[model samples]
Target: MASSESSLFSMAGDSYSKYEIRRRNPNPTAAALLVIDMQRHFASIAAPILPALRSTVALCRAAGIPVLFTRHRHRSPADYAMLGEWWSGDLILDGTPAAELLPDIGRDPGDRVVEKSTYSAFAGTGLEEALRGMGVEEVIVTGVMTNLCCETSAREAFVRGFRVFFSTDATATSNKDLHEATLKNMAYGFAYLVDCKRLEAALAPKI
Candidate 1:
């Protein structure tokens, strides 16, 4: 009878472990939408991710959530030191078409625009303060170069104690492998993983 009880306990523990493995995040209370690097140079290359981005933005707008757009802008090699070298002398100078947000997801006066030189949007930008001011507790992150800027921003958000929801279909990278790797890492432990469709549903108005 002791062996039988032990076997039942083991079976129950296995079931509980499996349930834990498949657990999902409780829905976020207040989420800010982060649109990262949807600029001219990267947008065309990130065409696959665009539709999802657009849908997510629209859903967020409809839900009255704040939307923050991040552009990767750098000074010219002659004007800036560290970043110009990092970009191999190419510049994403302010006011250049390359620094402009993609037209499909147009920015409203109410939406915030942030210029960042580094991969992390929160670094060297007012993004953190702005989010805090708006009372944003969760950030829905989406955009180009999944392995670089998007991943970095997501990590920074996590470190800052903001819940991160990374949309898998709304992010891209020049290398497919790198993109997949970032998504896998974020999904495993770094951030909550939701596809655009799921996000849209979450943002939908309840009947």
Candidate 2:
């Protein structure tokens, strides 16, 4: 990677920060870490944040915060929805290697993995129910495509009553503009923006 994951935070300068109104840390006990679409199809865009994403998963696990992952793939044309038309069917098919989650995300046997065909994990995947069942009131969103799946999931989580913590560095997109746009959108209305260092401090053990 040309730029380290920590450097991704430098993009969240005055423009993005100006939209931030509420600055609050996450409640670990009531929070779950959401790893969204960290699959092979998005390897290029996801590579820069893999280190930070792995660290985030480890930190949440250490803090006893349950971790959930979302995998996006179209089983068939029937499940493609608007995605098939939008990208002219340049979609991830279910049986392909691209549909598989990156093995390095530190996903464990007991961690919940939700499969969906759309941008928002909660759209038809029952992710909201799963989170509620786990007694999770807060979600820390991290993974590939900051302006797509990650951002959509974070916004959906917010509307569905979960306090969202959107990671600035642990999430990435095709370009800096889309990534920064999502950060600003999150800070403005949907979620509180967070970075790896902030998460470290928030999830640090109390004396």
Candidate 3:
């Protein structure tokens, strides 16, 4: 969990609810979509957001944007790190279907996949370097557990200097409250909170 002390990094009051988020057209060559931890373990919690994710991914693809997916896995006890302790020893092991990315999304041959072992994709992962190498300046985030992995990556991206755009309707958590809190926090501080429809429209190709 992130510290809530920073006002623009983790706002937790009624004022945050009044933020008016505006949609912007991200430069296709300078943006990437991060699909984080939408695996079997979070299937039920993530189901409702699949349509929105699918649409966002499709639009990104059509616009020539890179769609990067991160699958969280623990290959062995040695791979667990502090996450295991924090999760009370629970692990999403490798070679198990539980750690696999959901097949329903519109995955493409040009898409990239990065494997991670922690809550934040940038932790122990070369995600930042990879994004930098691709000339990516803005990042669009979507995936499971709005209050956890998704939120963590959004904050990480912001602090690392990437313009962060979080999909408000394309990410999910176990419950509504958890999802809403993270949305408010992100809107108040870390990223621009966008809906699927607004994003698709903003990314629409010019005729």
The prediction achieving the highest lDDT against the true structure is: 2
Clashes of 3: 0
| Model 1, C-alpha of 68: deviation from truth (Å) | 0.7
Model 1: worst 10 consecutive residues (lDDT sum): 1-10
Candidate 1 or 3, higher lDDT? 3
Candidate 2 residue 115 C-alpha distance from true site, Å: 0.2
The alpha-carbon deviation from the true structure for residue 35 of candidate 2, after best TM-score superposition, in angstroms, is 0.2
Q: Give each model a TM-score.
A: 0.81, 0.91, 0.87
lDDT of candidate 3?
Answer: 0.78
Predicted structure 1, TM vs. truth: 0.81
lDDT of 1 by residue, 1-207 (tens): 001011110010111121121324324357888999887767455666666678878877788887899888765445455655666635567787777788877478777788888788999798988889888888988886677788999999999999888777777676555666776678676787776566677767779
**Better lDDT candidate (1, 2):** 2
Which digits, one per residue and each the tens of the lDDT, describe model 2 over residues 1-207?
Answer: 111122233232233456577899999989999999988887777777888888889999999999999998888889877888886646888988888888888899888899998899999899899888889999999987788888899999999999999988788876776777887789889999887788899999999
Please name the candidate that would achieve the greatest TM-score relative to the true structure: 2
Model with the higher TM-score, candidate 1 or 2 = 2
Q: Is candidate 2 or candidate 3 better by TM-score?
A: 2
